[model samples]
Target chain A: MSDDWSAEVEELRLRRRDAMALGGAEAVAKHHERGRLTIRERVTRLVDTDSFKEVGTLTGQGRYDGATLKGVTPAPYVMGLASIDGRPVAVGGEDFTIRGGSSWSGDRKKGGQGGFIEDLAASYRIPLVNLIDGSGGSVTSINKRGHSIFPGVHGFERSVELLGKVPVVSAVLGTAAGGPAGRAILSHWSVMVDGTSHVFAAGPPVVERSLGQKIGKEDLGGTQIAVDLAGTIDNRVDSEEACFAELRRFLSYMPSNVWEAPPEVACTDPVDRCDEELLSTVPKDRRKPYNMRKLIGHIVDNGSVFEIQPTYGKALITCLARMNGKVVGIVANNPMVYGGAMDVKAARKQIHFVEMCDCFHIPLIFLVDVPGFMVGRDAEAAATLRDGMRAVYVGLQATVPTYTVVIRKCYGMAGMGTTEKNGLEFKIAWPSAEWGSLPIEGGVAAAFRRELANAPDAKAREREIEAELRAMASPFRTAEAFGVEEIVDPRETRPYLCRFIDAAQARIRTSLGPKAKYGVRP
Target chain B: MAAIQVKADVAGSVWQITTKVGQKIEAGETIMIIESMKMEIPVIAEQDGTIDKFMVDEKTAISEGQVLAVLTR
Candidate 1:
């Protein structure tokens, strides 16, 4: 009976040490040599110091030797509740060293950690962050478990629920194929390391076996393919540290949950700060291209613009920024790309971005400079009109306060999608704005083609007609006719935006309720 | 020498050929202009190279992601 509890305590400590080793020293060394961090190291970097409280640390397949316990090595996936930037969040990721983070054979807890973290985040009403890196479902586990069973509902359902309830973020640290890749796309904000990470439905070997295609891992699902070509992920960073930093910056703009308003900070930039360069940023010549990003930089609070999907929809720019200490989403036309015309990709990008802002209670600011929807056979083949209509539908259904500034040529259906059909809080236009069913150059060619063809001097007649129509398309005419709300000086854009943000903040304070009747689609 | 393919990002009619074949060009130089939606969009080279040849003639319609030109660096 002497010191009976000492031996039991020593055994518990020894098992804990084995569980922490995580696939032994050699596997971890390989992970570090490849410029990757361990799962615990990543979690430590993501959360506040000493703030992680693990929920399932000692859960794994237990081993025994004739009734005397040998040990229980933990599962490859780790999850816990943690504080990020002083706010509570549920964080989890795969320990790739342990059998490539494969599912355990005959283990009921297989595919359980993701759902557990999702449930924890939903119940706590906190944001969820997933650091994914694995081989997805284990193919070899079927050999040991006899057979694999397909559940009626999977972790995706929980992920969808978490989307509507809180902000969900995912980071692909390494090879994330199949289910893990899907989780990366399902997130509200996602990032991948440039050289070290790859995401796809199947890795190269699988693709080669199934389709007889010889492709490398990077070629199959590299940063260029995912971020630039497909636009599946939000941003690509150079290192894991940068990925975590981006996640923190993204969460700072949104509320902890959908029920609350977005957090506001003390803005150092003056609301009345005006940049004189804005007056000339939009070229007087309609055919010339001007930088929209420079104008956005001047309008928002200094150093506050965080652009999303920058490479996907080159024509349209959608970003998050702070206006007088309040978070607002900005959607602008990039004249440098396709002359700021709305194409199929731009339409889809705008639709998804508008819905995200509306769901998260962020006010919208639209800088309009659209020539119209892309036209011709290619546009028809891409179904640009259908997607353009969807963009219009989402724009109309958005409940958040919208402020639209018409900087230049706003023509046709594409121009109409920049604001709510019924009304908006502030629908101001700059002096350079022009609006119509179509640009006179194209319209004259269509409507009065026969007239010009019949004239003695066809070229001269066409030029005269275009000049007359162009003069009448001025934005001042719309203002005098009580069509447009007001025509403001370009330098006053910041002041107008700040005024709208103040109004939106006041309105949001009165109505902090559920965002919509449905959840956001991936 | 490495061959770089320049593709059109939008569908449009070739408005003009801004560069001649075998011309030495720098990165970001306009290779050609395509007219779509009544606007002329300049297709720029992504790398410093010599224009190998034009894939589409002037006034011809081109689709998005179509290879417009080949360059050898």
Candidate 2:
């Protein structure tokens, strides 16, 4: 009995030692202070309630300096497989208390679990969710620049390569700066907690030393800057709890990847249930902006619009939505972002989303208010034209049943392609919808720049030009040229687009080809 | 002087002409902007060129491999 008791005491002592080594009280205190959940907490939230199968929970070191405690387990991150909503998914999260979740495998010894988890994800064809947080290769610790920088332990590049095979999703729950942020960048979809999470190539300390800018952490990688300015990330959430909710919403519709179609949900909204408000939801003026998203929500099946790359392209909003219980791709514009200006970034986003939906044989319901392409010197530097043109090429080449409804401002490239090719398919436009080579304001600026500038009465002449262009930009004007198929009442948009999707879905198998390829990003 | 094929990044129809046939242009000069999605996309010259070969005329459709122009220095 004494011998058995001693062994039990020793095991308990080692477990206590392991926890202490990973930062022990310090890490717990820090987690509480920041209102951030621990790695275990995050993993539970990601997987179905109590469905997580943790592989290496007791692997972190509890030593002060290193996990060299002979008998202690050494791991900085938790790696395992869990089923989200009953489908298997591979997930990983950093234990920040353990040396700030630094990656120091020292030649694959400490970081082998991450590799094992990735292999399971790739082999199983399940979705991979990386609740990634922390930096790579700790320089300050270890006998010689520490364990995180060792060879054969880097797991990021492989993740990027394996993106298309399986649906990869990431949520930046904390300050996921540096190498960790790159993982999130390569995902099919990524969400960031606005106040809790930040993504950047480096932290403020590095920036302060390198650029001589002592910026705050928020400035370094805030949600607004990443979501709004850079246009690199997808969505920004109000809190960590909301981030998980967004993740559930995204994973609900998508399967693993292109190999499997989005899971069908039992939708209750009537297939013919039409929202008549769409008729007047858009502004008549080509230069004015309106809420295209609201109209999309009302038309799609109840709570069915799953917008991908929502933050990347404001000019074009691409989503996988459902109508009458059938999945469809929604490509619309958020005029709030760039006056619905389709730029290079928007082009990349639109083309990728279009290609994915096409491969999956999903019908496309393109909500058009696209104000052509972005303009001026800045647009030139961005190669906006290059990207936008590629989008046009993809849209034309796509074989899915494309139904377009011209909401309000469907001028330029957006106007022509948003509808079926010269009325090749069903295209309905509202009376308020306008189509032209350019917005009258921009057209007058370019064709008669000097004339408009030199006019004796500039403002009044501008108004007159606006009126003339408004007359020229009407949907009636476009329909007269056989550009638009039929001009319908705006209130009937939901019913019209729904019928078009039904027509398109029945004809998917006949048009499958290499052109119908999958992409890792949208 | 060597020539590089200035291929369009995407397939689209050429719409606006921003350069002349015989213009001595520096690298990254706007050759012509293609119109797609109601947006004007400019095909910039990567190197200096005399616009020696204007393969695509304005309002003409060009695919990805259908060269827009060739730059010869």
Candidate 1 residue A399 C-alpha distance from true site, Å = 0.5
Over the true interface residues, superposed, what is the Cα RMSD of model 2? 7.7
Root-mean-square deviation of every model:
3.3, 14.5
- DockQ of candidate 2 is 0.02
Error of model 2, residue A36, in angstroms: 1.1
TM-score of each model, in listed order: 0.90, 0.72
**Where is model 1 more than 4 Å wrong at Cα?**
A1-8, A104-114, A151-153, A421-425, A518-522, B1-36, B40-73
True contacts kept of each: 0.36, 0.00
**Top candidate (TM-score):** 1
Model 1 residue A352 lDDT? 83
